[model samples]
Target: MSSAVIDLKNCDNCPIRHRAVCARCEPDELEQLEDIKFYRTYDAGQPIMWAGDQMEFVASVVTGIATLSQTMEDGRTQMVGLLLPSDFIGRPGRVRASYDVTAVSEVTICCFRRKPFETMMVTTPHIGQRLLEMTLDELDAAREWMLILGRKTAREKIASLLAIIARREASLHLGKTGDGFAFDLPLTREAMADYLGLTLETVSRQISALKRDGVIALEGKRRVIVPDFDALIDETGDDADGGLLS
Candidate 1:
């Protein structure tokens, strides 16, 4: 399929624009991004970069979903990160990818040549500061996932993943209803299993159990409706009185 065209004019309205590379940049700095940024698209299931492959650019998701995964010698794989629209991908300083990046859905990315981007970041303090902030947020998310993998129960892991996805989707204005909302589950059972450190059978079983308990309603295999956000979080094994961010 042909790649989707990215509208540069929409950059100002992007949810992450202020929180990402352009956050601290002057109008002139944004003009530089317009000059060097280009669009690339990947089909569903396509590998954007392989582990240890040389990456020539850094990118941010313009549309659709992607995943970062690492595999062991024996073929056991773990999903380390999920990328959504406006989420940055690839590394500024790294030449070789540490994990395999794959498009979980048809995806469009805003790309910049690494050399120019690196130089621009150095010359632009705003962009550099924004990138540092984003990196720190990603690091925190990675540590949260580590806790999930190391400590949470199967049901709690599944709940935590669903809660995270729902919160992000809602933040992106993809919610279907009020605070109680519905959205498609972007990952497959096997993908969920990889992310949550469970067997596919276990993932399937837990999803079914959640449906049975009325914590979530399923319109189909991929569609989910959460009627009570707090209840879903309760299933995640977080402190009952704590807030979502806690």
Candidate 2:
């Protein structure tokens, strides 16, 4: 979320280079993708795409975070997913979006026209295969989210959500390890409440509890510093060892 303007010409040095949709492409394929690719930026809190809107393109988040949420006719809203750097923005073959996607922070996205990208997916086995892998990972995360909603205590939910974002931020910036790192909380208390199925008061209280217990440290309202990422992970109620039992 820097104030500097973006230039789209340098795809080779792009920050999310290894994790993006074109991660597996060869030079020739990447050249072709560059020919069709475009970049767009959204300010924090801006709506990127509304639910049921006809999507003109698919995108990969180049930087920053976004939220996928839904709104009812009566105006009730729930946050359903998060889009981090390297996260795919739209589904192939889907012309209309099913959820409202809004920028949670200053954001930039690498975009591909939907029809042409769909055609590329059909012709390029590597692209299709990689996309399938990403899709499966998304499915697994979604199921884990279901478990979080249905089973986790309120404190565990906050810890789990923090761990997820911290891990992604670390991967994007500091490789895969999360220790001795800091990231701004992408969601507001209200948004976290919606995403975690808790009241805003509950979200605030749990976060305060984590801070009190030294699982996390906060600078002002949003910045989170993890002195020991392992400690935070332990609070998430997940297997600390990721134990393999026969």
Candidate 3:
């Protein structure tokens, strides 16, 4: 864990600038944000926020991955979601965090003081509009996860997770997905199993199966290379365009 510093000098070169909550901000509005923004970095496996904790700021993920999980009364925890680059954390008017946020990899976020951010949201229509769009997208993703967990087969589930990560990585870097695109798997097999509701053995087996089938290649334990993005999408059992056939 580390504290914040004034580091807005690189805002123009920020990788997630076009996709983040500030995407719609005008230059003047961005300068307004810079006044309140600072950076926070967390090491892998660090807890960013615990459920019910007071949230002093809202942020956008600048890099790395994090998980949103909840612990039940019985002490069992479920990983409910992942936050990738450009993902927003905290919400306007929210005084406390709802889930446990943990870093799955080394993470960096650009944070704004909650009070100032909330005030800016009132005067800045673009910020409010973009947040609403992201909220809706989150809702859609939650519904899709319900389908994946409730009905998808083990192989399909693994494929779906891979496709999701690959797509997000591509969007942040290349603006698209295609053959020969490579990305590092941020989660270990055990974590993948926990997130997907499968056994570690099952997670390893499905990954091996995908490799054997030539749907993907592995440069190492964590680096996954897709030979054909379409094939991986096929394995996910999802519509290619994520829409009803038209």
Candidate 4:
């Protein structure tokens, strides 16, 4: 991966500033972060970190997508999570990375040196509180993923994945027009197959089926247009309110 630094955007103008780890910071806190922050860019498919590597800094994704994967002794790797824009990249108390992180798209991150960040967290209650909230959010998403992988059909899996990405995009104030939205599918069919425990052909077939049924539309190969967000959610086999229906 290239280690080149990019021109830094001031924290106030950063796209992810409001949702990122520094979201709750006051003016002084932001200034403190600025003192410690730097920007790094990585090309798509480049390794950002390996399992068991020393992590000298913690970061928040400023743009693009990344993935967290773990490799087994047999040399097989399973992607465990996706880091969308504004996602945090490290745990404060952790000295080493537990998963291999890779850029799924060209990515940029705002990083703070670990020692100073940990000290700041001790002095700054907002940072710690926000981190806790984000961790719990991640845990909830993991539970949903377990249900998807264990019980959902192939079609449901694809739809669920799409819905998840679309929801994340919506949170970032992107691609929303009423109840419909659009986003570029970041993962290849092969990658989606691996993550969803389906064959590549099955992944393609299910996407085609979604298009045929008017649940979604496509522009070129990767851009997906959800005509009705609720209609797409119906295909995920999930309750609209995220609870059991009466």
lDDT of each: 0.84, 0.83, 0.85, 0.84
Expressed as tens digits, the lDDT of each residue in 25-123 for candidate 4 is: 887887777778788899998999998999999988888889888778996666778887778898888999999999988988878889999999899
Q: Against the hidden reference, what TM-scores do the models get? A: 0.89, 0.87, 0.87, 0.87
**Collision count of model 2:** 0
Clashing pairs in model 3? none
Model 1 shows how many backbone clashes?
Answer: 0
Candidate 1 Cα lDDT to native = 0.84
Off by over 4 Å in 1: 1-19, 174-180, 241-246
lDDT of 2 by residue, 1-246 (tens): 323335656665343245656677787777767666778888899899899999998888887889899888997788888887778888998989999999989888888888888888887778888888878988888888998999999999999999888887787575655466789887899999989888999999999999999889999999999989899988989988655653
Q: Is 1 or 4 the stronger prediction by TM-score?
A: 1
Instruction: Name the lDDT value of residue 170 in candidate 4.
Output: 80
Candidate of highest TM-score: 1
Instruction: Give stretches of model 3 more than 4 Å off.
Output: 6-10, 13-19, 175-179
Q: Give, for candidate 4, the lowest lDDT window spanning 10 residues.
A: 8-17
Least accurate 10 contiguous residues by lDDT in model 2: 1-10
Model 4 spans > 4 angstroms off: 7-9, 13-18, 174-181, 244-246
What digit string (tens of lDDT, one per residue) describes model 3 on residues 1-246?
465563765565343245666676778887787788878888899999999999999888888889988879996667887887778888889999999999999888878899999998899988888889888999999988888889999999999999988987897686558668999998989779868878889999999999999999999899999989999999999877878668
